[model samples]
Target: MTRIEQTFITLKQQNKKALIPYIMAGDPNPSVTVDLMHKLVAHGADIIEVGLPFSDPMADGQVIATAGERALAGGTSTRQAIEMVKQFRQTDQNTPVLVMGYLNPIEIIGYENFANLCSEAGVDGILMVDLPPNEADDFPKKLQHYTPCPMNQIFLLSPTTAFDRRQSVIDNASGFIYYVSVKGVTGSNALDTDDVSTHLKAIKANTDIPVCVGFGIRDGVSAKALSAVADGVIVGSELVRHFGDDSIDTKTAIDNILAKMDELRRAIDG
Candidate 1:
């Protein structure tokens, strides 16, 4: 099984929900990305979603968009992001590392070449925000062909998604389904747990694949609320906001991020 599949299996057996944290590669600088990744695992991250810096990130909110800007300014490219994963794999062979980004960089690198690089870097999965399942024809095939284990193509399903589109995403998704909890962008504050629970019920009824909720989850209370219905909780903007602070040192930034992660982990495990 892929590392992602194995992780979900183990979590299911233990009756525990996954805690996935998102970090932009080279947020403050390229040197700290891998170390920050290891620190995230130490603090209680099950899966780490490393964001590849893009010129334009349409789905991200101001917090994450600013992070991407910092990353790009530090000279982090798509290849460099993959290299960070490779460095992270030196010690962390178990925790699944997913590369989350837009599709333009991959297009520039070419699908086959990007697949090969990801496979070599030991990337477990990929989440391209703009690539719909219907439009992704040969990319998934290339990933599967290049990797020793099948690389998962994680897809997003939002509340606004039509039934047919949701079905298509569910059918194509492998690692897990990223159920966007809110209708707005990544850091929007409009989270309603009751509505999330209702939508999750409809989604889980259709597929056995694990569904992880993301967006609008900020702290222990919200994480706890979402964990009741989701197989996993993904914290992005809430976590990324802790990094890239000019006033504080990188160590302090990571400490803040880990403190938040610890709270989320405790709440999820409770």
Candidate 2:
């Protein structure tokens, strides 16, 4: 099985909800970006989502969009992000690394080359927000030319999703289904756990593939709530806010997030 698939299996076996922490590559600088990754993994980041910078990220909110802008301004490129993955692969070939970003940068690098690089760099999956499942046959075909093993192309589903559409998306969803808890960006609001649970439970009952809920997940309480219904939880703005705070101890920030997520993770399965 692919690593992404294996990760879910392991998570299921352990009765633990995955803690996915997102980091925009080369934000601030490559070294810090790299350091932050290691720290996150050391803490409790079950899966690492490395975002590639794009000029215009429509699916993103102000935090992530601004993060992409900053990374791009700092010379972060599609190629550079892949290189960071390579660096990360040097030590961590086991933890699944997923590249999440816009399609324009991937187009610039060429799909096959980018996919090949990711496979070579030990990336386990891809999550292009703009790419829909209906047109994924082309990408799935083109992506075949590259990875050493199969690479899962993950997709997202929102609450407004209809049964037929959700079924189709779930049918096509590999690795895992990124179920958005709310209709907005990754952060900027408090997640209504009841709504998240109702949505995730329905999706879970419909498919065998694992479901991971994201957006507006800030603390362990939120993660714990989502965990009761979903297999995992993704945190984005919670992590990005750390990058902007120059005064807060980054180690502290990392620990705080770790503690919060860990608390929720434990509460779910404990």
Candidate 3:
């Protein structure tokens, strides 16, 4: 099994939820990104979503957009990010690393080269936020080696999506399913557990694959809530806010968020 698949199975057997954390590559600094990655894993992150720096990020909020821009400015190209995965693999091959980003960077790098590079780096899978399966004709072939998982957005205006559609998405996703808990973009408010439960349980009814919920997950309470229902939880923007380069209290802020995330993972696992 793939690293991503094994991690989820391990958590499932333990009767615990997975804690996945995302941080933009080359943010704060290129060197610091890897350091923070290991620190997070040491703390309790089962899956690490390495944000590949992009020029324009649509699905992201202001916080992540800024982080991406900074990483781009720091010269965090697709190659650099992939190298980070290679370095990460050298030490901890157990934790799955998923490259999360826009299509522009990979487009510039050439999809064939990007996929080969990711496979060589031991990357488990990818979650291209803007790349939908309907439009899979354009890039799916190029990313064949790198498994793609569609993010499921539970919304009100759309009412709900049919099972056939979600099952198709799950089939496309080789690693696992990314269940977007809310309708809007990232960095929103806390999701109501009832809304999340209804939607996720519906998803669970369709497939046996692991489901990881993301977006607007702020603290221990929020993480614990999502973990209680879903197979796992993903935190990104909140972690970005922790690495505040502009703030005088950057180190302390990062330490605080890291500590809380660790504690939250313990709460879920223990």
| Better-scoring candidate (lDDT), 1 or 3 | 1
lDDT of 3 at 165: 61
Query: Which 10 successive residues of model 3 have the least lDDT summed?
Result: 150-159
* Candidate 2 C-alpha lDDT tens digits along 41-111: 88777889999988888877888788787788889988889789888878887888889987887887887
Give one digit per residue, the lDDT tens place, for model 1 in 29-139.
Answer: 899899989999999999999999998999999999999999999899999999999999899888899999998999999877887889899999989999999999867
- Error (Å) of candidate 3 at residue 228 is 1.4
| Winning model by lDDT | 1
RMSD of each: 1.1, 2.1, 3.9
Q: After superposing candidate 1 on the true structure, give the runs of residues whose Cα lies further than 4 Å from its correct spot.
A: none
Flag clash pairs in model 3: none
**Model 3 stretches with alpha carbons more than 4 Å out:** 137-164
Highest-TM-score candidate: 1
lDDT of 3 by residue, 200-248 (tens): 8877786787888888888888888778888888898888876655654
Which runs in model 2 stand beyond 4 Å of their true positions?
141-146, 246-270
